[model samples]
Target: MKKILVIEDEEFVRENILELLDSEGLEVFGAENGRIGVDLAQQQQPDLILCDVMMPELDGYGVLTTLRQDSILATIPFIFLTAKAAKVDFRQGMELGADDYLTKPFTRAELLGAIASRLKKQEAVQEHYNTEIQQAKDRLSYLAHHDSLTELPNRLSLQELFKQVQPQDDNYQEVLAVLFVGLDRFSKINDNLGSDFGDSLLKAVAIRLKACVDDQDIVARINADQFTVILAKRNHKKDAADVAQSILTSISKIFVVAAQEVFITASIGLAFYRRDSIELQQLLSYAKKAMLQAKQQGGNQYQFYTATFHIISVDYLNLETSLRHALEREELVVYYQPQVDLKTGKISGAEALLRWHHPQRGIIKPDKFIPIAEETGLIIPIGEWVLQAACKQTKIWQDAGFHCLRVAVNLSGRQFSQIDLSQKILQILRETGFHPQHIDLELTESMLVSNTEVAIRRLKTLKSLGMQIAVDDFGTGYSSLSYLQEFPFDILKIDRCFVRNITANPHNAAITEAIIQIAKTLELKLIAEGVETEAELNFVCRHNCDLMQGYLFSEPVPPQEFEKLLFSGKNLQFSPKQDHEAKVR
Candidate 1:
């Protein structure tokens, strides 16, 4: 039975309405005043409330306002019983949240009709609310199982699918291959290009990846730049290899995103389900290991999971974990390698090299963990720390009477591409009270070549700050000497590869000399790296290399040791001095 509340000041009228509602099969409640009506409404939480206009303690408008303010009783339909039916009186009740109204002497049929109509509409409003709630839940569920960007199955969904694919019978196992495809230098694209462009590219890559597999193959985006494929009924190793190669080719093709053509490559790693393990996580893990191995061996190829890959991957993962904590633990220290002017044999500047002093592992060279840092995007923060530390230390050295001491810090690809990079470096220099003119920022040719316009803009921004910019690792990338005229580079550092055997190897000597000659012709400063022998030193000095840093002069030493060298006035003694009266610094 429906419940109704009757709040009439007159006892006779209240009893009459209560009895009448009872006869109509409604379980009824009665109150003498508006105050009692509000109390009864909250206790009963009734479907509707009937209140009178005139009452001693509280009026009908007051009762309605109280009920409407309550979360529990707010939705109940409320009717005002008022003798006055003027427009102003009706407006007052309605404005106070009165749902419907009844005249002083209302008919039974009219009262019942109003109650029934409101109850029906309330049911409809509740139904609509429930539907909206269900839709929100459905959207959340879809997001949990799918990558929001590509709308591809996510890692969790892939694991669930793995469970369904696993057969119950111990002996009967389907021949399956789990492959993980990783995009090479995907981080570079994300760091250089905007995320919107990178997201568009990933979505395009997803479509191409799906096209590379059959209907039976399940594809998922398990990570930011990693896609996984589960091949069913393909047991042979060669079948998986062929699919991997196809995927590689498809990824390597030019991608047109946002009206721009982008070229990227992929490396794949696959593990046979039965050959590796029946477990899904194990298989995926094995595939990922091989994927890392392929990336370490220089990307754009496929590799099968080998026992050796697991060892290497574990080492990388552990080292990456340690590196993440190394900053907070104060294990990372900046080591300065003295870069000496070949002609004067006096220390010109020092290149700031990062070293990890792990408590358990002793001194860890950068090569062991720098790639891990680069791949994980840890280079940005670590690179910033190095800048701050280098600038502060160089400032200290200058204060100690070494006024001309210059400090050079390398910029990671991610750091170089950041839009606020110049501002950040400028802020650090200001905080450290270091002169921007005394600091040199070194970046690779590959970083500049990625987006020449952006590189030029950023370079000019840094240049405006009075800091020198050098293109490090010069000949290792695809950039030609024309890059010298294209970008605003103040110095070109010869890569260690060519400088290592410049005297012995004819090809290396030719390349090194050509770089030096072009840089000399362009009138840019030159620095030769990896000069470990007297012959290598003589060879670069013969070509008028302005500065050189290697084991021959000094290996990268701790700041304390470098400070000692500075205090002791250690200098390289070399002959065949070249006059630089015509050269501008």
Candidate 2:
């Protein structure tokens, strides 16, 4: 029921107004003065307010002004009750934001008509605003769940759809398979034809993919040039494979885009459900790995996830378990690679790379185990150990008078996600007695893209604590020049891929040169990684690269061996032939 508040100094007039409103089916409330009326309006949230123009302590104009300042109360219909019918008085009340003015001795019709008109107008305005709000919300929801380029459901929508179709009971049975499809050499097409052409091609691909699927199945775009098909009610593995082959055939057909006949082939990876219970993300990963395997074999092919993949999955689990014990077993070690200043060929710093010495496996590279550690969330503790060990080593170097060299430690994405990451590093610094300036934290571009605002804030905190930040694997990820401008970074390490092929591939060389120019323009220290050859070293040096780290100097070694290099002094020069021979060995 609607509510109305009546405020008047005269007791008879206030009671009469309340009685009239009550008779009209409104829940009526009364206050003797403007202050009490404001309180009543707030508490009851009345649909309309009838107040006297003159009252003790506060007047009708004063009440109107005060209510206008409040967002909630400002919208309430207010009609002032005044003794004078003068034009000046009506003008004053309306100027104060009163909805309408009713003179004293006014008939009941005038009061009722004013209230009715104001309430109707308020209802219309509110309805319009609500409609606009809902439309905006719907648009946002659609954008969130769909790919903007192809107008296909995105990963988020895929997850939601999977949840909707997923069985409630654990023992429920259904034949379903997820097929991960990726266009081979799509980047080449994009690079050659341009992004607009690429977008059109992707849209065309989406339509073809959708056409290949049944009405009961779902097709979604998960990544750039990557799409996923959910084949529900497939009877067996063969059925899924047949669907995959059909999709491959459909996508491999020629398409005339922009008056050019473009022929493209796709790789398909199929992972079945009900055969093994798996989470949505894990299933997607399996399919993606299978797709990559298919691509490796050659495009226009399909590969079903096999036992070999399952063995790798089991191996990952075992590795995670082994890593948890690695720190306790003293199997985890920090290996240091010296960073040489290209200008002076002097040791300026070193990066602390993590390694694991398995009892049976002998030695395991980080690439094989780091992803497992990250997936299992073991990187948090493992990262802490790395930070502590690296800091202690830096302190040891400082105590031995190697004060000019800093140590860089790579921080995993999980570690950076910690809310207290800065505080934890500070605690480590205090415990190890290492100067904050002597340590640098290396992060990849992927880490910065997920929660950029939070990453920036956390990085700024670390910077304030005197810790250096470096963007590792610089050109390999989705990092843009804007990232460099917005993020607080002290160094950019050119990824090994570019440096390794720089001499043979002009494109790689051009990218390396562009990175060098960017680093120079930003005044950030540039370090070229994987510099294995004398020619690569000379190329970087000629470009005025700030620092260099690769086998050309020394492979990452244990702390004791690195200490020997430190003792040999900062300018531990070696001939190009000698460095190349060492790299070969």
Candidate 3:
């Protein structure tokens, strides 16, 4: 029911107004003064407010001012009741956001008519607001399950959809294959070309990719440049490969962008569904590794993941099983890499990279198993483990009177896609009794190239928690300077590819210097990665680089080794000469 409020100071006039409104069957609330009327307006949130201009303690103007202060009530209809007939009086009410003004001694019929009209308009405004709210909610829900750029089902939706394709019995175990297709250097398209045009091209490509599949087949956008295809009826490796080739052909056609025709190639990797242990994440990992193999083989091709693949071996399978049990078994460890200040050569921060030690196979590299964990939806648990481990270690260091340093953790692309990643980070800090300033999230360049809006939002949310965000491997992907400005990134790590050649060629040296200058101008901290030699170190120092990390100091070690290094208070020294003929180590 719509409620109406009547505001009039005069007792006789107030009673009369209420009586007239009551006779019309309106749900009426009343106040004798403007101040009380404003309070009533807020409490009742009426459809319309009939207010008298001349009243003690906050008049009609004051009531309107109060209403306008609240965004929720700013658009409520307001009708003024006043005896003052001056143009100035009318102008003052309207300028104060009043909806209507009626002269005193007006007939009840006239008052009723004006009230009805304003009430009808208010109803329409509310209806429109409701409709927009519903539409926005629907879009958000859809975006959660679908890629915003291509409108294709996202990885989450794919996982849910794949569960339905599972085999019910071993006798009739349904066999299928998933092909993971990734665009080679897709980030370059978005960075070199404008984002607007890049988005349009992706939409067009999605349309073509979707068109190539049948109703029974499932196609989803899983990564920035990656798409996944579920071949429900294909059980054999050759059948899956044929389908993969067909998709490559469909996507190979020239894409028209801004009237400029461009041809791009795709790399595809295939993993048989049932053959890959019947786990959605495990299958995705195999497919991605195979896709990487295709990319490594010069792209524009497909590779079917098989037992011959090094990552799908018995050792790898055991490692995956061990990783799933690591958290429960309490077998995860964190190793810290020091961030050295170029000017003072002192440690400023440490990046906490995760490591796992298997009882039988010894220490396992993150590159080998982290993708499996992420694909298997084990990242959330693993990420939480990293956060808690890092925070607890930091707190222990603080208690030991070690230098106060920020510990950074690499955030996978899947981690950033979660709506609660930032909140979870903050919650971990609070629960662990750690300071927000002691942690940061390191994300790759591809994370930003996808949905920048979502990436920016997550960045801002993390920044608000007093945690920092860094772009890791800065130069390897599509590095956009404009994104550097728009998004809140506190650090930029120059890719090892660029840093490797800094000491040899004059052109690479100049490019490295330019990048340093750009980072300096943007007031972003710069870190040179893969610094293995003194010459590279000196070159980075000469350019006023903020930090350096590579074999020159030490390789990524175990937690005990890292702790020993930190406690030794030792400064690493190296020979300052390099062979001109020597290439990067």
Candidate 4:
């Protein structure tokens, strides 16, 4: 039942209004003045309030204003009771927020009609308010679990979904795979175009990714340029690979963004939930690592997380931790391997090699730690250390009368891509008091394949500084003769893989011979690596190779040992006894 309050200075009028409302089936209360009426309304929380215009303590307008200030009572219906029927008096009450008004000659029918109409209007407004409140709550809930820009489920939402579909109390086991897709070189596009264009491109990519998945699978935007698809009940690695390849092919197509045609590719990594127990984060991490490996191998491909990858990931984490402190602890040392003059049979130069002496693991080979350093970006600082140490050592040897020996330092892809690479190298030379001509920077062929123009520019700048540039591990990368012509490379070092079994394998011998001819045709000096036997050395010599470096000459030795060898003033002559001892060491 609805409750009503009637406030009037005249006791007769108050009683009449209360009785009329009570007879109409409303629970009615009466007050002699506006102040008492407000108190009664607050305490009883009546559905409607009928107040008088003129009263002691508080008038009808004052009562309405006071009630409006209280949140709980603000919306209650208010009406005025007045003796005057003047238009001006009615206007005053209405302007003061009156819901309805009753004059001196008002009938019972008029009073009931005003009360019923005001209550109906209040009910409508309350319903609208409740609906709006509910809608706002729903919007907030969605925003919490989804990406605001893409409107796709975010990492938190993905985690919650995983929890729902995870293996439960039943004996049946379920298999799932998480495919982490990363757009290769998306940042370049983002930078070339404006952020608005980049945002639109991401939206388009999201649409394509969603369309590629099944209804049962979940696709989420896990990062800025990365998306993840959770393939529940599909445990097979091949199924995940097929999906990844489809995604790669779809994204590799042309996309029109902001009226400009753009082409992009993606690298994907898949981690499966077979019978093994793994947390969501660990699985995601594994997929991420595999994706990065795909990117490192030149993107536009897919990789699956294998047992070997997991072991490597753990080792990578541990090695990254140790490498970060290697410089500070002085555990990194430079060893020099002689680059011999195969023609003159004299020591021509040395290559600076980095070796790590772990306190717990003894000496760690570069083959094991160098890749980890490169992946973790520890190579930047570590490469800088090698450059400085090599330059300083060369200057030391030059001062000690070994002026003919130049030192070569291998630059990783990350180091070679630095914007200030040439400047950094020049600064190191200046600080070490070494001539630029005596320091050679060896870069891999793969480094030049990604950004040929930028690589050419940087190489030109380094060449202009009087430093020699050599392509290390040649024939192992996807570079053709055209790249050799375009790049400002002074030497080409044949990869050790080809030279290791050149005599035993005719295929290896043919490739070596072809590489030597190509080097000669380009008029670029050739250096044969891993010449461990006399037959390999004689074959390289027969091909007129410019230099040879391997165990046949000398194993890489510490600075002190290298200095002793330099002081001997003797060229390395191949000896079976010395080669055996070097291999053992």
Task: Tell me each candidate's RMSD, in Å, in order.
Answer: 24.9, 17.2, 15.2, 30.7
Instruction: Show where candidate 1 strays beyond 4 Å.
Output: 23-27, 311-585
- By lDDT, the better pick of 2 and 4 is 2
Which stretches in model 4 have alpha-carbon errors above 4 Å?
Answer: 169-174, 274-278, 306-585
Question: What TM-score goes with each of the models?
Answer: 0.53, 0.56, 0.53, 0.51
Colliding residue pairs in candidate 1: none
Give candidate 1's TM-score.
0.53
| CA lDDT scores, all candidates in order | 0.84, 0.83, 0.78, 0.82
Q: Which ten residues in a row are the worst by lDDT in model 4?
A: 576-585
Judged by TM-score relative to the true structure, which candidate is superior, 3 or 4?
Answer: 3
Per-residue lDDT of model 1, residues 1-585, tens digit only:
778888899999899889888988889999998888888888888877888998987888888888889877888888888899899999998888888888978898988888788878887887876675455334435544777568898876788787777667767645678999999999999999987799899999999999999987789998789999998766566887889999999999999998899999988888987678988889988998898888888999999997776445567788989999999999999999998887777888899999999999999988898889998999999999999999999899999999999999999888988888888987897899999999889988667765889899989889999999999987655435456778888998988877885676775776676677667757899999998877788788778999988887788999899999888878876443543221111
Candidate 2 residue runs with Cα over 4 Å from true position? 163-174, 310-585
User: What value of lDDT does candidate 4 attain over all alpha carbons?
Assistant: 0.82
lDDT of 4 by residue, 60-162 (tens): 8889888989878987989887787899988877776788888876898888888889999999998876665444334434544677558888876788888
Supply candidate 2's per-residue lDDT for 358: 96
Question: What number of clashing residue pairs does each candidate have, in the order they appear?
Answer: 0, 0, 0, 0
Q: Pick by lDDT: which candidate is best?
A: 1
